[model samples]
Target: MPVFRRRKGNLPRLVPELDDATLGQVRRRLETSWSRGSLDTSVIALVARAIEDAGQDWDRKAHRLEVLAGAAGRAVPDMWRRNSPNDQGAVLLHAWSDLLQAQRGAEVDLAATRDACHLAADLLPADPIPWTLALATLRLERRPHREMSAVWREIKARDLWNREAHLQALAYLSPDECGSTALMLDLLDGIRSVMPPDAPTAGLEIITLVRNYHRAFGADGRAGIGAGEHWRRPDIARALDQAVQDWLRPGFLTHATAVADLNVLAYALVKAARADEALEVLRATNGVATPWPWNTEGDPLERFSHWYGRVGSA
Candidate 1:
């Protein structure tokens, strides 16, 4: 019952982000707003409703806010903040959208964005979303390590299993980002020692392995060389084994972004030449798909469905 379905109408719908019936409704509203060139008041009301729907569930609130921010038209957040400066949702969305834009090579006012984040954290001290966004912003800016660590501490202090917070950390410490390979590996190792198999971070290790694999071969020869066999290497194969054995356990990954994490795992399993394992994971998605690894191929849903078709009867 996802908002988006595949062509030929077979498998469950595959949205680019984590979604449910409630979020589906919010997405529809946002879609309409976009079609009509929505102004701040209209979009803000819709986004505010979504935030209220999230209640006190930090994970759900974080996911909803991030999704809505990404889905909003580029000017939406700026106007929202400008018009509704006192609303925490607008403040956070403004910062979050700026972070997204900055990641895509756009110029953003980091200082003002940082101020917005601090103001948001002050407005809702219990919520980790602001700090999480701040962590990402700090990462993108390649600010001092102590600054990154400080923001990270605030996020973890609020939501210990914050998936986005951990993701930002991984990206920040990545070789392509501010940190080195050894630092990234150390971060992964630290997480494995303490994090449970089913926490929101269950997909972190697999993501690291997959991204590192791609970083090595890259876009040039990944498709040209012995890609299939590359995944069967001892390290990657072992990581896949761990993910398959642990992540697929029912009710294990219960966080808000669980579906998105499953998509990552399913994509990794597919690339690892483990179609059988991938099938089970894909079915668990119930048609929810992320625009990640699959997007690396083409249209996310199309690529995902192609793989699903290849292994359907398994």
Candidate 2:
């Protein structure tokens, strides 16, 4: 893992940490390419090498693609596709990056993206990434549930426990995206009882409940509170309790995305006014924090830092 940090004596300063050191190296290399205004064979080779090395490891592949898609300039994938017109990596990267832009309110050629996903599927038929990104696309488009389900079936056939696959399904069923609260709760019912405690989605129920907790309060994550606390609700409390009890146990959460679930646990604990309980989970993260759950409240780093102090001083 490549460390990016700006630590103070007691403040929480965290950055993204990739389980693959090479991926972190790849990101730094991409940054250098972008800085030098050079997009060359090295660019294509490095990106493809990372993807190829990820091979059929669906979870790591998704994480690598996400890091690339997020770290890359839109032009990188476009140039790769233009030069290596039949490269499967280029097709997957282009479509995935474009879909991410679309989610952030950017306008894109959705039809072309769909075609690229189809191309990626045919090029690497056993891989689940193309279909997973397609699931993300369908979610952004607010496409009908039936259509999303069809895409999901495609992903499940390739990799049933794919973290991003189930996450997309969770988001698609979430009220924040397309589904109703009742619908999101139904999805939770399907997940909570069965998802393995150490799976990529270890803290999934906490995620759903936390999002629903925010929905009650408004988009800014601090709007409504008329006497009762959502965190104190019977079922929500139990879910948090389960996460704290199991997630911190040694040997659990061996997935590539374990840090992400740990972040969810820390965030939920703090949000539920159990900041002290989050200390162990936060330590397990080892200074890698994600922007979700915290982002909905305010600057993610600031919020996490505040809790770091709150939990520490206590």
Candidate 3:
């Protein structure tokens, strides 16, 4: 017998509304739907939309759905017996939601995120969303190269051009003892090619590439001077400064691409000894709390603070 075998009776439906009371009501009903042991796809989709409408307060609804999704993933045989496509979709949606929450400074469990990603991978083999999420979780956990190598192989076997995959790969392949510059640049070029013209990601990739180029080849090489010295070059400084300004425009705010670009810009400015401008940019960017996941770190914050502090003393 399936865990979510719908009783041969009337099924409960969620009420439509964007208000708090209505959202609350819908959330409760969805919980009940999950408790019945059957994954309800329609209810899952509705709940996802409702949570999105709630914006920052989506946490409450997301928590409830995440429990249900986990249950469905664990009870796969039961879900299959119940013929519950909804249950499957609910699992993926809930995982994606949880991953987003974790990316946000929330206290979500890494194990849960990994499990969700694995379930999503099995359920949506053709979909890049699950693979992307899984790769991200692996990177966050800082798995060994052997483990990451397998994940990277899977990604490469599929669509190597996916934005999320490329971005995640960029982060995973750092310039530290673990990564190769030639390989990283190749990945960056792939990322650059697929970036949309107006997308802030294009600018962000350019900055990352430039930074890495200098790091690998040194200031005097073909990539030009290091950021610290490049500011002395009027043309180079002007171009970078303009790119930073373009990323700060109102239309680009709240985008992951913009956040990455701003982070790179902040670093570039600091290295160029423009502490005041760096501080101003960081302030405008909300100082590290951008909504988009994937690249949230304190390194930029610490570096900016140190740079500004030193500038004040000087």
Q: Compose the digit string of candidate 2's lDDT tens values, residues 1-314.
A: 22213344324655454345788888888988899888777887898999889877788888888888888869888888888878898998899889878978899988789889999999989998899888888887789989998998898798767888888888888767888778877866876677666767676677776677666765444643531377788887888888888878887777777877887889877777786688778766766667886787778888766665544444
Query: Which is better, 1 or 3, measured by TM-score?
Result: 1
Q: Stretches of candidate 3 above 4 Å error? A: 1-118, 121-127, 137-164, 206-227, 230-239, 253-257, 275-283, 286-314
lDDT tens digits, residue span 7-106, model 3 = 2211111121212354556556665766886556566456556444533222233333333343333333233324544443455555655665666667
Q: Model 1: number of clashes?
A: 0
Q: What is the lDDT of residue 84 in candidate 3?
A: 43
Q: TM-score of every model?
A: 0.88, 0.88, 0.46
The local lDDT score (0 to 100) that residue 256 gets in candidate 2 is 72
Give the Å shift of residue 154 in candidate 1.
Answer: 1.7
Write the candidate numbers in order of decreasing lDDT.
1, 2, 3
The clash count for each model shown is: 0, 0, 3
Q: Best to worst by TM-score, what's the order?
A: 2, 1, 3
> For every candidate structure, what is the RMSD over all alpha carbons to the true structure, in angstroms?
3.3, 3.4, 14.2
lDDT of model 2, residue 254: 77
